[model samples]
Target: MKTVILIGAQGHMGQAAMTGLKKHNVITASRSGTGCDHTVDITSKASIKALFEKVGPFDAVVNTVGYCEYANFSEMTDEQWDTTIQSKMVGQINLVNVGLNYINNGGSFTLISGILNVKPIPMAIADATTSGAIDTFVQCVAHELPRQIRINVVNPTVLEEAWDVYGEMMPGFQPVPGALVGKAFERSVDGFITGKVIFVDA
Candidate 1:
């Protein structure tokens, strides 16, 4: 059986992926760590290192953690921006750097980005920039990963469940189902594509 490691498995998209890829042995890491097989802080290299030690080797590693600030650029605080960058941008990088060794040769890596990278929503500067950075990083690093390991990213638009929270705010913006987002992850792991940014809105 293929072994897959997931970060932020307690979150909406993570849980959905867990259900979608039931055939694989899943190792989940998160802050709360509830429902996950293990716990790791995406922000810390040591934590990620410890996590890999416990899980042993994996066929693929998927990251579904990241946060973004939502507000007019002028209203965005330094703290808010840092929170977004640290968790989304730096966390993903850290995961790859520390977790890559745990993946078997020719394995795959899937990272989560957002539609903001291309859509450029109002008051979403940090998100857009971080998302773009992630895509670029994947492209640059894909050439460096050894033994045919592939790297890809999934960029999903607003989720269907998110509508309830911000439905009134986004009048015309349609939300995609969480299950659909999960499918994108499945495709990234199961397919042979590499250095591609898979975008899903419909």
Candidate 2:
């Protein structure tokens, strides 16, 4: 059984991912540290490094958390933009950068990205931009990783489980089941494909 590190374990998406990964030895982590095995602040590289160091060797890392600010394009502030870039784009990237040291050879890294990048909506410019950036980052970095390590990003649309919170903003977009999204991550962790964006849109 592969030892997996699952970040953002307390969130809805994280819980969805946990469904499919239940068979594995999954280590749950989150920023709040409530109801999870550990706490980690993805925005801080030092926190990420510390988490990995404490966990020791692991076979895979699945990150289901990244925050982006939502605001009208015209009203968006510099701080909002910075928050999106730092948390969604750079923070996820840092996971790969720092995790290389502790992950076992051939281990995989699975990151979360939303469908906003391809399917745009109002007031989500920052989120869309960062989502696109994450997809691109995974596609490019997959070629450079050593020791047969693999990486992929899961770009799922609004989940059925989260529709109540995000449905109105998404308009006609269909909400997919969390189980389907979880399977995508399972594929990335157990399969050989790398540098791919596994989309789970119903």
What's model 2's lDDT at 1?
88
Residue ranges of candidate 2 with Cα displaced over 4 Å: none
lDDT of 1 by residue, 56-83 (tens): 8799998888877788899999998998
The true-versus-predicted C-alpha distance at residue 170 of model 2, in Å, is 1.0
Clashes of each: 0, 0
- Index of the highest-lDDT prediction: 2
In the range 1-202, model 2's lDDT, one tens digit per residue, is: 8999999988889988988898899998999999998999999999999999999999999999999999999999999999999999999999999999889999999999999999999999999999999999999999999999999999999989999999999899999888888999899999999999999888
What is the clash tally of candidate 2? 0
Q: lDDT per prediction?
A: 0.84, 0.95
